[model samples]
Target: DLAVLKSKFRGALVGSLLGDCLGAPFEGELVSSGDKIVIQKYFDKLESPDLKGPIRSYTDDTAMMKSVAKTFIDKPEVDYTYMAKLFVKEYFAEPKRGYGESIVEVFSKLRKRKFEDVYKPAQEQFNGSGSFGNGGGMRVAPVALYFYNNYDAMIDVAKKSTQLTHTHSLGVHGAVFQCIAVSQALACNPKKKIDPEQFCNELKQKMKEVEKENDDGLNLKVEQPYVDKINVIQHFLKAKYNDELDEEIGIVLGNNICAIESVPTALYCFLRSLEEIPTVKTDNIFRRTIQYAITLGGDTDTIACMAGGIAGAYLGEEAINRNMAKQCESYEKTIEMADSLYNAVCGASNRA
Candidate 1:
């Protein structure tokens, strides 16, 4: 079981890295029906054993995720200040990772304030409504993997760490939703086929509780937004895959940077890829998950990153093509980080 878990840890991190690197090229372009064909060929080429283009570079999604995992590995205690410092340090060290303007502001403010109030900069964003961007959800895979066995701790840390940059209820809950999805995927047996209906139902129930606890009674425009998104995901999953259907999903589920839009979209991508996609032409579900996420178009890197993390958590590292994984920049370092996070958690549990 430990061996299987270790492989999963690697799978989740590598999957996240591959998605960011591979999906970065098409982050904002809207994919038409014809574009899917080009996308399919693109994946086919990427998977070729002999193909040697420049390694696909990762974006901010991975840049931030590495900091999150490092915080867990290097600190025996959960330290928000330390994690905040890592995020600022990483951002400043390499400012061209495609970080959004809003987060750049948050990082600068954090550094200026000397991390005295880690959450203040984020809370001050968008006229004090905070960021609803998927920045939180995009980088949350490490929390899911680190607290895979501890559901309450997973939820707690997911919310707190996300609050460091995203305090909006939608942003915070979306990260929670993504974290729960990855952990659920991690718990499934890799040898068994995933039941999409069952997976949606379980996610729906858990999200009900998560949403209920966070109800502020002021934002009544949408009740239980993430839960409603899960229901929509279920509906879309049961429908046959088609270009028209994808259009509807894009309109309804969305593919933007907003956590409410993109996080559920990522979860849907992972679940839908569980079956054969007529266009993708991949028997490998791991590839299907990220590729399908990319095909959805907007915010490609983060959506793919989140979906890839969930898919990898389920399938383990062996299911990912080594060639494809090697194509991502820092792929080796991602594996090492996953291993360190695993050893940190499991090693502590063993000592306990």
Candidate 2:
């Protein structure tokens, strides 16, 4: 079990890296039916053992994810301020990682204000509504892995860490939803097939609890958006996979940057990829998950990254292709971070 957990940790972090790296090149492109063929071939080329090219570069998704993992490994106690600093530091060190304009502004403010109030800048964004973007959900894999055994702590840290930039209930709860998905995937045995219906049902139940607690007396148009998305994901999954179905999913579940749009879409990607996709020619489910996500288009990197994390957590490292993973930037360092996180958790548990 320890070995399995360790492999899952590696799978999750590395899977996230692979998705961001591979998906970055295609971000924001509308995936027409013709485009799916190009995406399929692209994946085939990346998997070829003899293929040689520059390693695929990751976007801000993996950049922020790395900082989150580092924070957990370096600090036993959760440190929101330190985590905020790491985000700012990583962004400044490499400003060209495709971060969104809003988050960049938050980083700039955090530095200007000396991080005296780490959560203030984000709270001030978008005329106090705050961002409901998928930024928080994209980087939440570390929180899921670190607090793998503690459900309450995982949800708590997921919300707090996300609040460092995303304070909107939708933004915060979406991150929590993503965190729960990854945690559930990590708990699954790689040797067994996952029942997609059961998986969504479990997620829906947990998200309902999360949404109930999030009732802040603000009567928003959609009271339980994520819960509604989970219902949509369940509905979509029941239908046979087809081009038409894919279009419906894009329209209904969405493939955009908003957390409400992308997070559940990522979960749908993971669940749908469990079976063979007619368009994608992969025997490997992990490949199928991300490749399917990319074909859905908008916010490609982050959606693929989030979906990949869930798939990889379910499948563990062995399910991921070694040759394909080597094509991503920071693959080695990502593995090291995963191992360090595993040790940090296991070491603390053993000591206790």
**RMSD of model 2 against the true structure:** 1.7
Worst window of 10 by summed lDDT in candidate 1: 343-352
Model 2, which residues run further than 4 Å from truth?
A: 217-222, 349-352
lDDT of 1 at 39: 89
**Per-structure clash totals for the candidates:** 0, 0
lDDT of 1 at 147: 86
Q: Give one digit per residue, the lDDT tens place, for model 2 in 195-229.
A: 99999899989998898866667756437889999
As a TM-score, model 2 comes out at 0.97
In order, what lDDT does every prediction score? 0.92, 0.93
Worst 10 residues of 2 by lDDT: 343-352
Q: Which pairs in model 1 have colliding backbones? A: none
